[model samples]
Target: MLRIFVIVIIANAAMAQVPFLGTCPNLEAMQNFELERYLGKWYEVERYFAWFEFGGKCVTANYSLNENASVKILNKQISSLTGVATSIEGIARLIGRSDDPKLTVTFPSLPLPFDAPYWVLDTDYISYAVVWSCTNLGVLNVRNVWILTREPKPSVAVVEKAYQIIDKNNISRAYFIRTDQKNCPVTN
Candidate 1:
């Protein structure tokens, strides 16, 4: 009886950290994403904080096409605690076909497979992009959502549209944490 009780407690704790269970049929990636237009710097306006990104502030991602036709992803951030610049580089392989926003990123530093889905859920190309990714962990799904913009802060209306896209994906808005890009001492 005591062993069963312990198992129940462990299960609940695991569930609490998991983002969601099962698939979201309504959550769809962009039909067509222009690679050229998306090739630039993007500031992280908001996101559902992943464990790896804890204590990171003024985060930004820069994308460029490599000679091998893969996308080079450079993620940079300032440590909120120590105020130092830190970065990680990853390469994203285009999954399935061209023009599709689905990708799988692999980081050399990480031993565990970094081959996670990189889906562009919604993007205007020029201004804002809503990206989503999910992977099954045991019986539950761990999800990551990011709201990125060409500028540090997009207009409220633009952000509202991004939120609508997230809502359509069935992600709870309560989980989002707004990134602090204001007064970031670091420059490009």
Candidate 2:
């Protein structure tokens, strides 16, 4: 009985993963914090979507602040299929946090659209970039993800750090897939 109880506790502990929605480790607060600050454009540095690699080719993002106080996000995923580059566009809206400085994002076009909510988990004012995740994205499907600054892939240390944040926040991590575009290491 004692051993079974201990196993259950350990199993629960292992399954509790989340993202860090707190402030940056070295920075005090985000810069140009207005929703406009999140506007303009962004590229997928790394994501957790496996079936989509929906990456590769050339991926870019565009955003505009909407009148409803939502960030109008336009994500274009360009990938080569059988030597032809194809693109898929997606629209994401901020669901949680309007003034708290944090944002939880959701896509209204995908199959499970509103299900895998992407949270603008955290960021650093100094780096001009941010970290994002979905506590339910991965667990729900094979399309959970994260977006970042540019085309260049993140460093090993950065990946570990992001994992740490997710570990502490109970974010989903299943079926996570890192891309292999011009910016990432060759992981087959």
Candidate 3:
């Protein structure tokens, strides 16, 4: 009975919004990260499934500097079914050294007790970026990943480069799904 209970709990946690498994992976954030160069719009090329992003398409995130020097986050997404556009604003601040690409992001719209990790695993600032986050929860860990590009529809070479980084990091590609960027509503 105890074994059965443990199996059930693990199964339930695995079905949560974020993928949960063993301890968090040993991954390093980008070193010598330039905040100024990374501050711009990034379109979602691919990502792990997220409940809050269900039915969302043409997802994009815009970053800028806030008055307090914290990074401002503006995430936008359009509904594939309803064609409705929605967005959320958030704040991000470095969690480590100035050049470290590790940060914590908080959305005032969500009633969460703490900020979520937003770590840039790799990036070239101009073409592509691989972002990853993991939280160790004792018996299990929750993980998230996103492959972003400066353009909504990046070339094959650009995407392949992003995949190379993911492969090098040994991150599983099973959960990634391409984001639909076709017929997206234009913004000025």
Clashes of each: 0, 6, 0
* Regions of model 2 farther than 4 Å from truth: 1-34, 50-57, 88-91, 101-116, 125-143, 151-164, 167-176, 183-188
Give the clashing residue pairs of candidate 3, or none: none
True-structure lDDT of candidate 3: 0.87
lDDT of 3 by residue, 69-113 (tens): 899999999999899999999999998888999999888887544
* Model 3 worst lDDT run, 10 consecutive residues: 10-19
**How many times do residue backbones clash in model 1?**
0
What order do you get sorting by lDDT, best first?
A: 3, 1, 2
Model 1 misses residue 128 by how many Å?
0.3
Which candidate model has the greater TM-score, 1 or 2? Answer: 1
Candidate 1 residue runs with Cα over 4 Å from true position = 1-18, 23-26
Q: What is the C-alpha lDDT of each candidate?
A: 0.80, 0.48, 0.87
Instruction: Name the top TM-score candidate.
Output: 3
Question: Native-vs-model 1 lDDT?
Answer: 0.80
RMSD, each candidate, Å? 4.2, 9.6, 3.4
Least accurate 10 contiguous residues by lDDT in model 2 = 134-143
